[model samples]
Target: MDMRLLVGRNVKRIRTARGLTQEELAERSGFSQQYLSDLERGRRNPTIVSLWELAQALGATPVDLITPDDHAD
Candidate 1:
């Protein structure tokens, strides 16, 4: 899978695991709902700052968000 898609899926998984709605994540990340949706759909190219914001909002590290799974490799 594409790296963007991988990251998006990972973000979504973490958000769900944390029991947060998209709206809540967006609010905590200081991002728009549309933007968060786009990111989750892998339709937006997230900047480093955006990634950092997402990680912070999800209580995760950037490494966790972007790490490639061994199964994928």
Candidate 2:
């Protein structure tokens, strides 16, 4: 699987698990809602700084955003 897609999926999973809306996460991360949408859709490549900020906003570590999910066979 592509890393970008993996990261996007992780971000979306964590965000939803935390009960945060895209708009809310964007506000907390100081990013635009459109940009957050793009990130979640795997349409944007986030910089390290952006990832850090997003992780902080999501109450997660940066690695959590990029780590691959464990798949069940």
Candidate 3:
């Protein structure tokens, strides 16, 4: 599977599990809602800094965003 899609799915899963909307996550991550939307859709490649910010915002570690899902195997 593609890394972009993997990260995107993880981001979306974590975000939803935390009960955060895209707008709220964007605000917390200091990014735009459109960017978050693109990210969640696997249409954007986030930089390391962006990933760190997003992980912090979501109360997760950066690795959590890039790790493959348990169901991926």
Candidate 4:
């Protein structure tokens, strides 16, 4: 699987698990809702610092964002 797509999936998974909407995540992450939406759709490439920031917003570690789901091929 593509790394970008993997990260996107992880982001969406965590966000939903935390009961946060894209807009809510955007507010917490200091990123625009559009950006989060694009990211969830696997349309943007994020930097490591960005991953860190996003992870903090989601109350997760950077490794969580990069880790692949077991059910993912």
User: Model 1: which ten-residue window has the lowest total lDDT?
Assistant: 64-73
Q: Please count the clashing residue pairs in each candidate, in the order shown.
A: 0, 0, 0, 0
Q: Rank the candidates by lDDT, best first.
A: 4, 3, 2, 1
TM-score of each: 0.88, 0.90, 0.92, 0.93
Whole-model Cα lDDT of every candidate shown, in order: 0.84, 0.87, 0.91, 0.94
Candidate 3 Cα misplacement greater than 4 A, ranges: 70-73
Task: Please provide, for model 4 over 32-72, each residue's C-alpha lDDT reduced to its tens digit, 9 standing for 90 to 100.
Answer: 99999999888989999999999999999999999988745
lDDT of 2 by residue, 42-68 (tens): 888888898999999999999999887
Candidate 1: where are CA atoms >4 Å away? Answer: 70-73
**Candidate 1, 33: how far from true, in Å?**
1.2
Whichever of 3 and 4 has more TM-score, that candidate is: 4
Best by lDDT: 4
Model 4 residue 18 CA deviation in Å:
0.3
Better of 1 and 4 by lDDT: 4
Candidate 1, 1-73: lDDT as tens digits? 5767778888888999999998999889898889888887878888788788889999999888888865344
lDDT of 3 by residue, 1-73 (tens): 6777888899999999999999999889899999999998889888899899999999999999999897454
Q: What is residue 20's positional error in candidate 4, in angstroms? A: 0.3
